[model samples]
Target chain A: MHSDRAPLGLKVAAGLGLAFMHLPILLIFVYAFTTEDKSYQWPPPGLTLKWFAVTWGRPDVWQALWLSVKVASISTVIALVLGTLCAAAVSRTKFFGREVISLLVILPIALPGIITGISLRSAFNLADIPFSFWTIVLGHATFCVVVVYNNAVARFRRVSGSLVEASMDLGANSFQTFRYVILPNISTALLAGGMLAFALSFDEVIVTTFTAGQQQTLPIWMLEELVRPRERPVTNVVAMVVVLVTFLPILGAYYLTRGTDTVAGQGK
Target chain B: MTSAIRFSGVSRHYGDVRAVDNVDLDIAEGEFFAMLGPSGSGKTTSLRLIAGFERPTAGEIRIFGQVAQGIPPYRRNVNTVFQDYALFPHLNVRDNVAYGLMVAGQPKAQRHGAADGALEMVALTGYGDRKPSELSGGQRQRVALARALVNEPKALLLDEPLGALDLKLREQMQEELKSLQRSLGITFIFVTHDQGEALSMADRVAVFNEGRIVQIGAPETIYFRPETPFVADFVGSSNVLPPEFVAQLTGRKAHGALRPEAVHLSEQGHSATVRSVSFLGAATRIGIRIGDVPMTMLLPKSDTFPKVGDTVTVNWAAEDLHVMDRA
Candidate 1:
């Protein structure tokens, strides 16, 4: 697809598409440094690092940040285990209703966020589970599982059945085959899945609202700060931190999976 | 010639598909055996059965006089070199070769040393530090051979191992494999669809068709005295004369197989009109019609040759014509 020259119209269209997606985030980034706290006034705000200092001092913001990190990390770990197991079962075995099982596994992510949020709230109430840090972790794991499953199943299918057979022929038992052949083949996929799950869980909003009771994650805090303004630039500053944390892993995952379409021993 | 592996009435069926049906085989130690067949003829399935990758649905497989049906592939005393060279991507060539040893609890230092020796045997020394992806197809093939041979199992099974290589590389690998088998003196059961590879390299060949063995004999016996029409036509595309033609020539009503090379132009013999003429590099192939019975003959290329529509007389030695079973 690459030619010596790209037409001017195609280049302009690509530039406009990028701007349409990232310009709002750019505005959020600029407002984090704005001196004005009451309103967002374009092209008339002075810049200062004062809101960063204020954000650093607020203990409520610190608690919310700490809680968000804890929920995202645990949810990611849980999703990694459950999702990888689910993918292996569905992709590698034959059973009755296997297709239905796979569809049900991915249903959480495909449904509206509000629907998932409401369902989780009712399920927790029916089970008599307390609405605490665990509740929010539980809510985040729903979609996190979907993210990890999507990555893992694709890699598992591509890992080559011949590789497993080769391992056995080389005198490795099932456990050793899994350890030596299957694990190494799927490690990069698992890593990418984990990163994506973490990023999704970190700034989730609607699900956190229904599930959290007397506990505020970073996104819930930002929502509250928008409704009741106190040093509004502080919220933008926190939003900037959230953006960096999620964006870095997404970038890492992209690079990790790039140019890896072909697996080893896939000779022509 | 002791028995290395034996298959007694083995059958592998999948619902309505009979992949391998009631096959009985005996392979001797220190022999290079080839299973020759078309695709889906149960040849590769039979190899996998010996490797213990696929269990026989019925009957038994014995390895060195031991029952092999209940055992898994890792516990079997045999290994396989897969067609695609399934090398571990994350590992370097050294680690890939040492995989069996590593799984058997051999120390890293000792296994790496053994891996190097195996690589040297395959003429791939000093190439261990690179990954499988870094190596070419031929190089990766050697690594796969080394990986399986390093174990020194009782038997080695190869499933269409040269199917992916180009002409020159395939020919080179074939010679290397034959000589290596001779030096190792281990039983090698090779499966392939190419008759040339089977005839040139194997001590004995088994012809499979439709999930059954159609013929089993030494390669020369198979090439010269093909017992069935399928074997005659498949092995070298020999001219298959119908039973009526045989009745006219030999007073027998059985089908006959006549090698093209045995055909020669003559002065006082059966007259035939040339239908098509093709000039190969070393030989010319002429398709002739003898009273509406079409046959092909091969001859060394010469300036004085009959062209299309030219009527010529053809003859063969009495012993060159062989009676064969119907397909």
Candidate 2:
């Protein structure tokens, strides 16, 4: 009886917090179905299924959507390789300034995104490098690596060192040990980290702003369409698409890293 | 045949701390040798050095007459069962056991058959397809054993392999391990801090103190004729009589070691006041002070012994008190 009543206030507060956070997302969903397209209206004139067809035909929308997916995919791959390597070096070895190097790795994500963007912009200009698809990918990867590094390093430390030693003792070379033992142990963490990095890169606007010269990513395209009025509901339709694209990976990342505390020799 | 492993003046010093100081040792093929000491006594370090996990700072290591220094652990012809049984959590029991063979490019069908045999040897025949986390502590230990045994290594290095089990389980594993070594006839070198474990299982024991082997001998010799006070006090907790007291009794300026069970209550002997009494299940241990030196005697449960403050006459056979040649 005490448990039932004790959590009543907690239940109400939790409900309020959920509504406060999700109300805007609900508006995006509602606007996507509204019939009025020229201006914002509190209660839509009518609801229709016209914008879904409108969104499918726009070639510019296709271009921006393709660009965003390509950038996110390339950035996530780069982050997985470099981030995993850095995590292994810092967690598995003892060297002078090791702690400081780990701290510097996370600094990109910890600092303001605008600060990273400004630094990258200046660095590109100083080097006389032209901004393009690869430049934006590089910018996204800076923060993406931090995500993968955080996840990989934590899992690496949680794993027992003796697992590697045991593999080597069983007559495995360094590469064989990594393939047969270390890789399987850290695979889940890398997958989760990669998913989160992909989601982050997909929705990033601040870094893309300083890095992209003439490119219009999906989010940037949405911004331009919102300023100069066309079919307004089509932008909401595209927003709904973006929401679906980014939300699934974050959910996937959450489930991947959950209940993964079982390390080798952890039975006792 | 040449000895399975030999260390000639091997030393591993980290800064000023000698983790494994200059050590010379040998173990014959098909022999079970144990390195025994308290923690921080360099026994485990010596095992790691033999496994090629740590390189010695000076001197040489030879395995079957081949220079072993600078060789990677993967290149060495040895396998180690780590203290906690590091079984891969991701792999099932069968795959974990087959990992060594799989890494060596063995055919899948062949390696699986070998893994089955290895598992059956450890008496875990039908436990494949279960992850390491599903197994209990004892079962995980068996899986680790099977994994190492599948490789058929020339020598097996066990670093306190039974340390994590309960008392009864530990004793059972000790017996199983001894019989397994006998049947396999492979050189087995294990490091442990338990004196009873060392004396019971090993053919020869190396007692380490402060990164150096202070005494190396058979169990009976190590227990009865410890060369230094550290070994005398460490192994079985024997009574160490001071040099001055030994000189007074034997006219020899050397230390003496007397077993607690050897001390007898007699009609005529030196009188000592009982300081403490600990009643064990099978025997009662009595602590007494003979002058300034404290000594303990183990009396059987049925024997009539004095109370905590009572004065008693204690005597022992002359051979029971072994004098150390080097004090």
Candidate 3:
């Protein structure tokens, strides 16, 4: 429908809609080096790399950046393991309430982020768990698993059941089949999913807001700096870094998945 | 000394649908046994049962006299070449071939040498670095065959391994597969819907129809002495005529199956009119109507083909006719 040469009105509407969605992001990229301090000015008087140098030198900025990387990496790893297992179990096995289990795994992310954050916060409070690196990792994993699970499950479904049978018939046990056949087939999907999960975890703030008590991740740190008047350009600098770090892999994930229509898109 | 594999009264049912009805078969060691049938004939199901992919409903399956009931596929002494080949897309030909050995915990050096040898056997040497996607359909098929055959199992179950290939490739691979089986001296259970594939390659063929084995014998026996109408019609190009047409010829049943090649276009025998003539390269197949009954007769290219409107005499030897047990 989008490819069709419709009236100029429809094409202009679509173009405008796309511009509306991305214009703010484009502005951030454009204004990251602008001399203007507080509010974003369209026509900046001058541009400089001074903010990037300042952003690099700040110890607090480095701490928050490192924390974000650590949390995203740890959460992505955990999510990859658990989510792949969940996908394999659901896809390869026939069990009662399989659909319900799948829905439950994806439910945390499918619901509004605020809802997920509030509920997770309540659950953690009731369990008497304090906020820490582990808590942040755990909270991020709840949604990150959905991403990995979705990727792995879609890849698993693309793999033929007969391939597993052929592997077993050729003297591969379940583990060997998984290692030699199943793992290789699903590796791309896992990689794509992990990259996506890392990106999501890196930028996630709503869920982190309720979970993190004192630890300020990069996004949280950016939010704090955005509110305060001092060092506002530094937030834009950090935002520029965040965009670069996350955007590359999201683009990579799209190319990896867009080659074939994944099984996850079966109904849609 | 004993048969390579045996299935005694094996049956598989999915709820009410009997996928494989009670079947009894004994495949001799080193013999190429093929299951020839149309789709949904239980040939694949029987092969899977022997491979231990699924357990029989109520019967015994033995691999070299060892009961295979409840035995998992990995533990069984058999490998399968699936219809789609199922070659691991990530692994190259060599890795895919060595997968079974690697899974068996064989050392890397030994497995690698074995893999190289297997790839050489399949004429896929120097293809170890290229993934399955890089190979053509025929190359992929060879890789699949090498992967399964490298394990040196007691028997190999090929489930329509040539089904995906075009006619030309299929025929060429059929010869290669037969030679491979012969050289290895491994018992082979091949399943295919194409009768020509089964007849040309197998030492003996089992004809299947609707989840049951209709007949089991050598290719000659199946072609010449079919026991049922299904086998007669399925095994080769045959003309099934009602028993009344051959009543005067044979005093038995009211139906018989005659091979197109067996029916002659000579100047002697039963009288008929040429309905149509099809020039099929080396052979000319003519359709003839004899007293309201239509039949086909195959003749060598050297023989004169009767025109469509011409009258021709179509007949066969007295012993060439086989009575089909009409169900």
Candidate 4:
């Protein structure tokens, strides 16, 4: 219960915490404009925009970025369809082992990324499936579905059962009830979930590393460029772009879900 | 003439728990009917069954003499004003009221005109553009009623639609709903746990207890001539005389039920000592002990009300006493 004017100690601690989290990202932005061609330097000798032209000239960077966008978009679409259905089934009905099914759906995201990555890699090898774009999309969707399901299920539970019954009783069949009543209630949640799932899939690196065999997603390319330095500022510039691309949706999702808890006639 | 809605030997069970047990009822056309009961008393279950939200475990439900065994709610010619007034949050009042028509593929201009008419009926014509969240509780309730009535179904089911309002608003809405039903002349089947609500608004009320219809009759008949002890105690405040007590007083081995208002404070009859006196605005309720049996009597409020510890005599006309079997 801190007041509007927090204590001096708390204010300083909060500042330190934020700085700890964002200092490296700030450094990435600063280095993206630096003229340094080889290694990172404090106070970056001088700033220049030449790296933007060089990054744009690289076909490999374009390939990786396009691949990453494709994978995240397809993964998000898959997550939305499957996640909404799962949420509807879990929240709207009672069945045997429903809780177990919910637990299983969330387990992929809860487990360590390396474990998920390894399991996917081994499963792909055993099944004789090639490590391609579809494999990377599959790996990202495993966790993306969890994000969407979490948001959708919470909203579904909040929508009153009476709303659905009212729709049906007012001469709307099951399909119409979902379209008019259930859809309007859960639309914001589904949108927020989709945005969050897209953001999560965009910058994912560990899972992509295991699933991608000759293909390189944006994060994978950044890793390779870090190992072998050639026009180093280009990597930093690309990293800055990745940060912006992922940050916008996450921020948008936060605002979308902030006011979703208050539904009309819910308390009454 | 066909009954508006009929349930024949309907029994709905969830595993071993019987929600509605072998209930047979007939609601006449253009009559205001009420199913009155406490929580878990099968009243709400009966409403849902009629709405097609729940199927009966056995027997049949008929609408206008046609079997509604497998009919869905949308296909059945009835709409429900849900207890919580389940208005759509995303839509404004006009869109919410027009939803039933929109689903039926009515033209936009026709549905909008019909929605305005429905809103006007509820005295909410100017509130069309406002969201459900923007309306007050009473206003939202009217919108829900408008939404259901816009379809002009054969019968309308209301599941405690006034349960969420404050006391004053609830009383006001009760009168409004009764007058609205009269003007519409459509069959209304209402469900409520509040006996006062059922008594005030319904043409005939069904008293339910433990998954059975304990008694069904007009409000006056239910209050004065209850067929069972449960109905006698539930429909109103009544003194149910035990069989032994009745035998001692009337010299007959029978049970009796009498309303508190029926027993008046008198100069001579059955002698009793006043144990408690409660001043209830328009009336004074005096609790007394007549030999080992406790009884209550309601008397007109006056300056000469009896005080506790005072000895008094209470009397009732023979016609006021209702004979009933032991339950």
Candidate 5:
């Protein structure tokens, strides 16, 4: 049915929108292995895998990649645990200032990231703490928690509270209820949230600018490479890798979340 | 008898509205006790309090000879078959049934064996690998029962467990659950808004209204001698007659309730014109107007039915007339 029928105008509009969104990334991948020049070039160049080897050989690239991975890993782990706890505590209990707590966690993402970065930087300066890896991890985590917390809280609400009561009434304690009941129920949501948090931390640039002292994350390295030495092919190669690494998890997460909603209307 | 479940001066108020008010009750051991009430009558809240899901605002709950205040639900030797069943959607039937034992760290073989036995008891022997979503409503309900029974709780608290089923399935499950309770000989505290289910299945029933226990007795007593007008009206479809109609026999302001079955169409007694007659196969229900109060009388369908506008005498034994103080 899809292949045989569609209005021309609507189909063209949809095609244009998809191309507009993805054409630049496709171009980046195409030119990333080009052998023509130091400048970004189109179809004239021959293809080569040499730029990837060059990128792998650079000590500076490896250092920045390692730093980025370390920060993203730490930030994702911290965000997962803290976000799950916050979601559980807020969802399970009735208390004063619940809306305020919700607002605080969500505010980091809703407000401009620059504002979050500057405020965190100022707070760190006042506390007499030096800018370092931990600070960068902390800064990236501020926004990453918002992603994890929002996802986790939404999933927690979807789980029936009666299930918790049923578990408890059947002689399962609170921790066991969470582990065997609540956790498995929300596992897919948490998995999706964790992937998004890792992607966010891996690519985060603005907050890292304020939080990093001498350390160079991959994004910072890319920024420096773009402005200083015009090593266009090597930068494109790195960008291609970054796009692929981040894209797969996001696609997996989208599929994971989509499965639930597709069958939701059927049952209800 | 030492009470299996006791509530003494128990009360719970959500803000200013009392959900359960200064209630006192003693449910006997091994009895299939039911709390029957309309929605908002605090029956479910009292069950939750006894289950330790909710803390009483005042007084105490004693379960199996132990004070239940501040004790979590997991520590209480009582399980609940929730109104919604609330089966774990992600777990297979076996895992869900074994959840309580697994939580208590029972060994793998013992846990699986116990769960299997419980599943067999509920007639879900071969469906252990399927998730809750895969089961039919009745099967899911049986899984819920099996899950609760596997723990072998001292008592099982059922909060309208059959409320979600279709009528035929509900009837079948009711018989199954009642028989299961008798065979186990464990105390079963059941809650339902359906009076037929309560009266037919309960060994004894507690009638609740407006957050208080209005009456507690055997199913026959609850049906025949409801303590209040509310209980009478709530428990059965009563044809409420004004005091004036029965005043010559009972007294002034003594509200009278006649079970539709108790009133008969006779050639002699108080006369009323038939408004409508419904022949319901097994029985016929005749709606009549006696003065201003609307009255209904049930007669065997084999007996002659009065036609509309036909004047007929509605007669009953004086002892079948129930006099109550409140409506």
Candidate 6:
């Protein structure tokens, strides 16, 4: 291996950085099993499985979880359709203001979440559209589309233009060329983008807070529960579930994109 | 003979740049034709126009006596082997070869069998299951050939197909491609920038320069009797003597080209001093200067090589001189 090994000082700093990031999540997991119900206590006096039963029994928790799942799924589907089309247009063709259009597609994610939240809230009010489940889904899809488009555009650009031309030369129509040549080249990237979009939508809080006026997504529900602690340990258990839900897809997306970097006959 | 492909006043323009200016040309059925030119000289554009990848800005193209305006490439009865091979990375060799049949909605078994046969024709019969990435560069090139041949179009357009291979492999593939074209009896329209490749493989060649066809003839004629200064210089190494020099030698005030091989280092001829000598296996290329005009001569290698600054007389037959109008 030609890669140089990090010094002991750098390794120590990396270890400290990772612990600082993940230690709080570990704390959340630990407190979920704490016997104490009123407040968090370090190295809990006792441990029990009562919070699991308590979280399972809460109807509000189930409702919020279901709502979060529904919003993320719908948002992911919308993002995939809109993002792939936008990526194909921006990356494959030249037109007036094409650079401006690409910039606008990416602006939603690059801007602060609060700015996106406020803009979406004002737009909804201007249209007189009432806040509902679809409002939350639309809010999440704004940023979700950016994630999907970023992944798709990069992959589309990497796909050789000659491949499409060769397909047509081999007697394939535009649609057939897309089906045989273009789609296979971009499928993994699209899948990774869709997964990332889902994960982002599932855990979104800022935009959902403004657009979802009366709707209670899981993150919104957790925020509400944090303000009024009926059962503190139950909230910790729900936070554990949220972490697992978001982490799995992000991990899957990473693996999916890693395998796509070595496309056949690429760079030759 | 029926003309397999014809272009009448065809021109393709990109904004202000005319990639292929108005040109008229024809290729007979079962002829191995080549379009030879430098980059951006419109040879590839002409091939693309025939393949339906580019629409002619002005004029008409016909394939097998039918007008091909406004037709898409998929509907055209021609296939192209791209310079980069352009093999589908996600597909195995068999599926890549079967792509056209798949697009036509052929049954799986029939397409697979035909694909195998195409692979056999390219001498890659048992390598169908391999991915394009798994094969070597030369093998990948064969797969690309098989992919196009499986479609069995009336004409196969090869856009510098051997450009990516090394010189040795390129020479080997050139012969194989020629044999393949002969065996298939399909009109092959090959585009290349290499003059040697075009001359060696093509039955006839069209020499292109600045979006125009300067000359079209058999390889020997194109090399020996180029119609213009551009064809004379671009087709091979030639000393284009000034009209004054031609007038002095042949009593005609005209421009003429003399092949280096025709200029022999004789004991009594025009005296010139050798500037440089380079061995080329069976022959030696000697650069000489005569009357302030630099000339090249290819002489048979002998025991005593000519040293730089050695004065020698060069001569050639009048029949070897091809005269043209001054450009």
Residue B160, model 1: lDDT of: 88
lDDT of 6 by residue, A131-193 (tens): 999999899999999999999999988888889998898888888898888888898899999
lDDT of each: 0.93, 0.92, 0.87, 0.92, 0.88, 0.91
DockQ, all candidates in order = 0.73, 0.75, 0.40, 0.70, 0.56, 0.68
List runs of model 6 lying over 4 Å from the truth. Answer: A1-7
Evaluate model 2: give its lDDT: 0.92
**TM-score of candidate 6 on Cα atoms, chains taken together:** 0.97
Q: If you assessed candidate 5 against the hidden native complex, which CAPRI class would it receive?
A: medium
In candidate 1, what are the lDDT values of residues A104-212, reduced to their tens digit?
9999999999999999999999999999999999999999999999999999888878999999999999999989998888888889999999999998999999999
Cα lDDT of model 3 by residue, B1-327, tens digit: 579998899899988889899999999999999998999989999998988878889889889989998789999988998888887766776778898998888998899899989899989889988877778888888888888888988898899988878889989999999999889999999999999898899999999988889899999898888877677778886888787876767877557889999888667877898888899898998888988888888898784568998987777887788777654
TM-score of 4: 0.97
Q: Residue by residue across A54-165, what tens digits does model 3's lDDT show?
A: 8889999999999999999999999999999999999999899999999999999889999988988999999999988888888899999999999999898998777788
The list of candidate 5 runs beyond 4 A from truth reads: A1-4, A43-46, A262-268, B325-327
Better-scoring candidate (TM-score), 1 or 6: 6
Candidate 4 residue runs with Cα over 4 Å from true position: A1-4, A264-267
Worst 10 residues of 5 chain B by lDDT: B239-248
lDDT of 5 by residue, A145-173 (tens): 98899989988888878888988888888
Model 3 bad stretches (over 4 Å) = A1-67, A93-110, A118-139, A211-216, A228-231, A251-268, B246-248, B266-269, B309-311
Query: Residue by residue across B1-327, what tens digits does model 6's lDDT show?
Result: 999999999999999998999999999999999999999999999999999888999999999999999788999999999988989998999999999999999999999999999999888989989888888889889999999989989999999999889999999999999999998999999999999999999999999988988889999999999777788888897888888888898888887899999999777789999999999999999999888778898989789877998988888988998898747
- Interface DockQ of candidate 5: 0.56
TM per candidate comes to 0.93, 0.98, 0.85, 0.97, 0.95, 0.97
lDDT tens digits by residue: candidate 4, B100-145: 9999999999999999999999999889999888888999899999
Clash-forming residue pairs, model 6:
none
Model 1 chain A poorest 10 in a row by lDDT:
A259-268
